[model samples]
Target: MEGFLEGIWHPLIDNEKCTNCGFCYNYCPKGVFEKNNQNIIVKNPADCVDGCHGCEWKCPGNAISFPKPITKEYVIKVIRWSKAKGRNVSKDFIKYALKNQIIQQDEVSKEMRD
Candidate 1:
């Protein structure tokens, strides 16, 4: 997938709790997790998209923990990445994020300029 967040955010698997059922391996759309021999491991954490938690809930053993904080920088990064890919999501959403104080205005300005 394009613009996958990779290192910015990735799932943390608990080895002690993991049942090795491969749920994350099967469910990850971007191939973030892979089946290694009889076990499963995250092969490309950076390939995981921002704010995506599909693997967290899919793990029956509850071994996944993605503790990525969604800061203003992350918001801006996603916006810029999407725009660079020609996905014109509504500007109103950006305005709303600013008006609601979801992101700092300076951060948005810098992102737009970039």
Candidate 2:
């Protein structure tokens, strides 16, 4: 999951439901969220990374969204890396990823061949 992961993702706050709790601000390892005027804020959107959802889970107010989903090309790259590393991954794993919407079917074939 290193080197390259696709898609844009960041934590989004539900302001109304939010208790203005600073739990997310304190829990995030990347400091993506911060306490501003006693409210949680997305201080550094770019600092946020995909698949890192600690803040979302830690929020007592349940006021965060973990970015958009990843694309299929990204999944294929992961598959490729796993295969290249001789990991014991299933051949049908890619198909499962596509079916589950964990990855979209864009450029899957081309990337798989590489």
Candidate 3:
């Protein structure tokens, strides 16, 4: 699950529209953005909390954007792929999907329900 999500859903900063106001750097609780001299970079993209859009909403320049939006279908696809690959999809990930409203409780597999 971590491997699949590592670079999948992180924010992308468009430099053209970015004013380097540091809103993303300051607002992100995951330390995803870091100040590099006068510029901001996504330093720890993998550390970003899944389904969070706080930084995007807080950015005054509207420079922050995610590659993909979290949705029930997307979550289900990931779970199915992980299972196909014989990966142990963690219950915490399922719980996170449910808590974030990305997927409903019934969408989780019967084996995953426990």
**Residue 80 displacement in candidate 2 (angstroms):** 7.4
lDDT of 1 by residue, 1-114 (tens): 243554567899999999998888988889988888998988887778765667876689989987675557667767777778877644765765677688987877777777
lDDT of each: 0.75, 0.67, 0.77
- What stretches of model 1 exceed 4 Å from their correct place? 1-6, 69-114
Compose the digit string of candidate 3's lDDT tens values, residues 1-114: 445556577899999999998888888878999999999999998888765567876788888888987677777776777678787766666766788787777768653543
Q: List the residue pairs that clash in candidate 2.
A: 72-104
- List the lowest-lDDT window of 10 residues for candidate 1: 1-10
- Residue 42 error, candidate 2, Å: 0.3
Clashes of each: 3, 1, 0
RMSD of each: 6.4, 6.2, 6.2
Measured by lDDT, the strongest candidate is 3
Winner by TM-score between candidate 2 and candidate 1: 2
Candidate structures ordered by TM-score, highest first: 3, 2, 1
On residues 5-53, what C-alpha lDDT tens digit does candidate 2 reach at each position?
Answer: 4346678998887998677777777888777777778988777765455
Better of 2 and 3 by lDDT: 3
